[model samples]
Target: MALFYKSNNAGVPIGWIAIMLALLASMGGFIFGYDTGQISDILLMEDFKLRFATCETPGVVASCDFTVVREGLIVALLSIGTLAGALIGAPTADYLGRKYAMIVECMVFIVGVIIQMTARHVWQQFAVGRLVSGLGVGALSAAVPMYQAETAPSQIRGSLTATYQLFITFDCISIGARDIPGAGSWQTVVGIGIVWPVIMIVGMMFMPESPRWLAKHDRIEEAAAAIAATRGIRKDEAMSHPVVSKEIEQIRNHVQYESKMKGGWLDCFSLKDKILYRTLLGMSLQSLQQLTGANYFFYYGASIFQSVGIEDSFITQIILGAVNFFCTFGGIYVMERFGRRRPLIIGGIWQACWLFVFAAAGTAVDPEQNDSIGKLMIVAACMFILGYAMTWAPGIWILIGETFPTRTRAKQGALSTASNWTWNFLLAFFTPFIVSAIQFRYGFVFAACNLLGAVVVYFFLYESSDLTLETVDQMYCDPECKPWNSRHWAPAGYESRHNLVEQTKAAEAHKPIVGGEESRREDVEKSGDEGRTERC
Candidate 1:
């Protein structure tokens, strides 16, 4: 209810190396956002409709049921493909590791992009291309956050991962193309979408695999080297650093515990395991993000505005795009400084208010005759977007990334991301029908969903902000852990919360130089033992 600030009391600085890795992994998000934003406007284009929708006239709406169905499929198939990608990306990420899995995503996205660009037909080939692109989107969406969260320090993990959505908002790039004419422009824009994935593929060639993943795999030495590279420190120095060594130890302990316990989808549903609780929290929140009618604004912004009697929905969409883009910084700052729980609650309330207002305004007057009511609808829609952009949009990614223990992170992340796209596909596919059936009252459905989502956020969501990944693992293992009361929580002894510089200084000062290399190794091991004890 009040401002909850989680600072880096440990004085751990996020180095440029970590930032570089976060940014590179975030290219997947760029592709995700670009595809969503690009399609929103392109579906209305004359050439797009002619080639795909088979409509007889330029700038005319698809009136028949068949045309509407085709349009929906074109828009929704990408999500279908993404759904598949999330499913496959899970095991792929687990088996191949995050970096290589993303390289595969890039290749998939490239193939999809080429198919979409070259397609001369509508439902069959065009839909196939979209489904392929969605596969890339799904994989990237699953892999990027997992990669970023594992690589990042807990202090900035929220903001670093939120950069994925920031790229989504920045994906407002092709909004300008709406002003340009012809199908070639759309093709060129789709081609441009290929650049970010290509960047991800090429850039990942040089990036380190997740250190936590390596530690889990019993490659402790390589994990230490990766930790060193991530912090721009020497490998020997990293192996000896108390904080880095503690991180490795924590990863090892959690992985060991997970290995001892059998895991599967059944494990995720079992009341015997606290992990199932975390899984539901993440999956539900991700589902809520889409159900809150956020994508209705995204996938069908023009249609929603058009239904409310706005003549030039394209320009208005561009304006909303800009609004969505800039407001996301507020989310990033909030996620970093204020933690995750409060912003979500606040955003949910704010969204419910705007959505109800939109519904009221939509029904208040004839959009066909009353221009003022039409303008109000636009205003209400923008406010709704503003609320969503700052809260659920970015917060869902932050939650999903940090929610599960490393043992189930990939598979759980895949399930959570797939829930999002599944709901996304449903909303994108049925929005036209929902809009037609409910008319101005559709906002009411969204408003009610958001209000329900807030209750879930308060009762089910826990605070993981500013906690080390290792500490979070402990939070779930305890029998007394409660989702509703986690804001005031901390692991006993709290070793991971120490000042990084102080810890390093103390470890260095205790080095036994008289016994040479073996003594130094013993000191490092001793410090690591103490760190584990303090953390537990």
Candidate 2:
């Protein structure tokens, strides 16, 4: 029962650990995709019809056709639980640590799976198991990436974190493949959903605690040991590495400093400076991604296909899943190379344009002529997928993790993630209403949202590529650089743990350690100064 650890030694190959951890934790995303994707197919089943008919009001018979009203309510209710879980997850992770929070989420997921598997009624399953699982998925959506980002070495952080989306796409494909026979046997399809979280729980038994969490809790030695074990390094070698030692030291100093600051929810809002701006930016990024109508496809793809007169909706689901998978790879390849902001700007515009085309096709075509229009909309949808797969989806998480200071990282990550789930709920809940109300014009709503998202990105977001975390903070905190200013400052290598120690030492000379607030101010000032000085 040896625990896995990340290696601190140079050239020891940390990529494998990164990939392994990413793949394991990403089971959360898999659960999300499977549960969400399976619903569309389940709604098409005879079993679902029979179940719904039993609960129908008196003479009201349930229809075989999937109604946007029922579909939207189910999806929206799941999101409601997700929103609550996400909000709670921040505090849970902050207090219990990411690993333990994930463990608890596993239990929640188990409850959800069992309920969904055995439920005799659709409403019972939806109200009980689906909502329970949604809570687990929502919390994991926030926690897993935070855990991975905190645990992953800086070199491969983006790729490792992006694996969440990869697993999500993989889950979509798996669920779709399982449903190829259509809604006739939803029991089999829904049953497959339990496999992922069960695997994750088993994996958790083998995985080590997050080193960053260890560092935050004043357990430097344990943190170092955990890193060494996970990275396959000798404990002594890991402890001796200057980079590892420096990071551990900085974490200790940062945590000790935070211990003094008046810790409360108000603190997140009180900082009207750059920190506040960045926090809002992160929250907005998550919301914008949802508003762009991406998850709508994941949740309602089968219905969308049905709308286009496709007889075999499961086939379309598989195609969408494949398209999502490759398109996400396209995003991964370009993220680091081109930087964060550019890809988002470009991708947003492209997505907006294609959404309009999708809308136009959907609106203009009659059922008889849907053959050509459906083909066109499918291509347009793929293009939209390519645009989002390349930008926003993965990049937003990268920016959120990197933009915040280590002191507030977990809390901010949680808050922004909660915002994401809230918006997800909004979209999921309203989408059926929108589709039913507008009929073929639903694509227009998505197109408009994408356009709005594009505008927001262009005006509010900045380039975060190649800049170390510390440097990015400086760009936000520096008073001279107004919010509207377009000036870009090249940050130095201040992100290295060794550099932080030097900066901390320099700060110690200027101010006596009176309390946590004073000490934290000193660290923030020092980190900011270091970033500025290096740029000069």
Candidate 3:
């Protein structure tokens, strides 16, 4: 059962199976992105209007479009549902395990889709269906990444976890291109997402469970098998494999540390352990990710383009979506190539500059009357998308996954994600009114947010790049290691882990043991300085 593999830049085994597992888990993002982009086009479809967009206000003569409240409710209800779901997702993921939690959420999303498909009667039906499905989307957002972050090797974990955002950007572009030029039953758009969750269920059936999750639940044998399967190690020697052995030790040690603290939700906010600081940091990052205004376009791109006088605005939207999608690959590269804060801080200033131009261009003329504003807005929008996709979109998710300790990751992740949805909901609900009142000036608000986000990031967000998650927990434990100077900080545990891994590598090649073989096992188990060495 030996499977040969090449090592990635991070020296982890590179196997197609592991890659596919990340891709499959990332289908949750596919569904989420579809829902975000799908409705933007659907809301503009004449068929949708004919069926559900009758004037809520008493108009004198003909039927009219949905009232502001109704439209806002339709779009924002999902976020509300997701808020609850993100909160609930933590316990569900913990109780059920990451793999099965995803399966269950996928099913829930499908059932919500069924309800959405049947909604020809009124807008409420469709909106309710969206709200119902959001529960799954929200939970999947938490669980899928948790699974990916847990199972992926540290070397490519950022790239692998960023696949979730990749699916998001990819599908948002794909949906905008596929459905933007068409007019049909909105149900078709709703139904298409069912395919994603279905794929998730099928693919996950064959995937390994998160080894960390198994370890957390005290399933050591199954955890080793999971490591073996994912890392391409032989199952017989998987437990004794140096990397695997060290990883298992770290997980056990961390879990025991957590148990000793006996922390719960309150612990997440308590200053005594500095958990409060991390909770706020994760929440702020998530909130700022939304405030960056990328979702503004995906959620309402058509309306924005139409306001700027592009008659058939969908093509312009498709171009922007394409840029957003392609630049996200650039984001994956940035995640691997640089530390976390620099890109985001630079992207913030970049987005702010473009958004300022966008607002100024819109304010300089009547966008409805002047043809030039169209090009300017598109240019500005594209620039904004480029910066955001490469930085905050993937960076925030990557940060949250690495920021919190394993003991509190699920709940704390939900808190930050809930912040994402809350801001998402606020912007979704209020943007129409805001855009109508100030028009392009609305860009200024997010531009300001982007700037503030940069400053906050400079002062607060810890750099976790290139460090393993276990190393991340230990790094955060140090009182002296603040965000400003964290790049130079490494926990002693990290050096020990690296030394052990190097020893394991030497052991693999039957290289001479530095202190002979008899004491190696004792050295590892007890950190005993006693003169002995043993086989890895």
Best by lDDT: 3
Better model by lDDT: candidate 2 vs candidate 3: 3
Q: lDDT tens string, model 3, 239-311? A: 8876567667667666655666744677788775567888999999899999988877776666557756655
lDDT of 3: 0.76
lDDT by residue (2-81, candidate 2, tens digit) is: 22222222122353555677779878877877777667667656666556534445333353444556666665667777
Give candidate 1 misplaced runs (Cα > 4 Å): 1-10, 55-66, 175-183, 303-310, 494-536
Descending-lDDT candidate ranking: 3, 1, 2
TM-score rank order: 3, 1, 2
What's the alpha carbon RMSD for model 2?
7.3
Clashes of 1: 2
Model 3 clash pairs are 517-533, 517-534, 518-533, 519-532, 519-533, 520-533, 520-534
Candidate 1 residue pairs in clash (backbone atoms < 3 Å): 81-135, 82-134
**What local lDDT does model 2 show for residue 105?**
88
lDDT of 2 at 392: 77
Steric overlap count per candidate: 2, 8, 7
Q: Each prediction's Cα RMSD? A: 5.7, 7.3, 4.6
Q: TM-score per candidate, in order?
A: 0.88, 0.82, 0.88
